[model samples]
Target: MSESSPDEPPNSAAVLESMTLLATLSTAAEVGKSVARRRLGRDPSAQEPPDRAAIHLRNTGRTLMDLLMQLALSRVPLDHPEEPLPHAVRHFDLLLKLRRAERLTQDMHQRLLSLYPEVSSELVEEARLLRNKIARFWETAPSDPDSPHLSDVLEQGISFVVWTRHEVPVE
Candidate 1:
């Protein structure tokens, strides 16, 4: 058997770990969404009562999305004068942007639902359909051969330092 290069990932293990993490993240998001829906008493067939609770829920969702975006952006390496980002890196960037768009669509749907207009129902339905499509795209696109592994993207995102306590020495 030929020895694999150091840069070559252990495909099975990486994929399994990534899938597990994805499941966990998906479950957490679903739980959060469920709680929000319950608190807001959201019914797709019926318009939800506009209240502070619904506004708070929407704000919480937006905050979560903002945090996720910050985390993802932190992973991006500083641009070099001579070298371009790797294919996987670019794919990761695209993935993050798609996620933001998905979140925006979700928020739009929530807002449309609150409007409770007869004509707005059609817009809400369209937004719901778009959100579902976006979710599916986000779930499956990263696993493509040409795309970066989920674990790699997540690890990179989580590996950056936001602050340091150590003092820098003068040159």
Candidate 2:
């Protein structure tokens, strides 16, 4: 990937590759958005368009792509980690960008409480404890931290996300 001057255009392979990927993303987004339309379930004989869920799915796809791209491209605690992390040799969904991931843990905990009042206080506390564990996931330089594998919890979180991706009454 060659760097371009301010007056010139970038001719790097990365740029071309990104452009191609964006085109593909557009196609994929349309497919996902199309399926969400309300008219899809309608009888064709009755005559109607699709029943579109809403336009927000565009942001959904873009956000997912951004996370996927970040996960694929780099290792962490990186992309500018907070000061004082002694060891940062880890990269997976659970611990990637360890600092940011820890932050997201708290944000998600709050999001869950705001969205679902019925969510148990115990569960919220569990998330808080998990956040604390994550905060120290890479504290030790040459050995594992005190926390158990947080990826186990992340796996369940990812599973539930996938489950929600389906329509109601999943078979």
Candidate 3:
């Protein structure tokens, strides 16, 4: 009974809208997968001979959103973001630096927290546990504590979080 626009076909409007929605969703999935592979480092194992990307990207539709929400967790394969800072990836090397610091300033803690904030409690805890292990290892203290460690993974995950979560001075 109501008047419809002359250019619009009212009878087939629902069908047309459905088609549009389907196309939009399809495009969105395509774009999402492309970004996952390119930027997020799609699971290399999916490829023949296992390329060295970080994420395991199959059937990740549900968990992908959760993982993506994490600010510090990254797709890189490093143990820490600041790896090779002192030429090696040993806890002792870092432990030495920490011990050498005349004072463990709040700034140092804040700097680390900035990379992986308190919001990311699990990683912070993991890093702390690793530190404890390093100290324990230091007591017995091998000639070199250089070995495979999760410091790089922990470091890489300890990246700066979302902008709003951090302060940005207006420059």
RMSD of every candidate to native, in Å, equals 13.4, 13.3, 23.5
- Candidate 1: misplaced stretches above 4 Å? 1-15, 28-41, 57-61, 64-68, 71-75, 78-104, 116-171
**Distance from true location, Cα of 127 in model 1, Å:** 7.0
Q: Model 1: per-residue lDDT, tens digit, 87-106?
A: 44455556655575566556
C-alpha local distance difference test of each model: 0.51, 0.43, 0.36
Please estimate how well model 1 matches the true structure, expressed as its whole-model Cα lDDT.
0.51
Cα lDDT of model 3 by residue, 132-162, tens digit: 5434443543454663243442332233222
Output the TM-score of candidate 1: 0.38
TM-scores of the candidates are 0.38, 0.35, 0.22
Candidate 2, position 169, lDDT: 20
Determine which window of 10 residues in candidate 3 has minimal summed lDDT. 49-58
**Which has the better TM-score: candidate 1, or candidate 2?**
1
- The per-residue C-alpha lDDT of model 2 at residue 34 equals 51
Total backbone collisions for each predicted model: 0, 6, 8
Q: Give the top-scoring candidate (lDDT).
A: 1
Report the lDDT of model 1 for residue 98: 57
Ranking by TM-score: 1, 2, 3
Q: Which stretches of candidate 3 lie over 4 Å from their true place?
A: 1-95, 101-118, 143-171
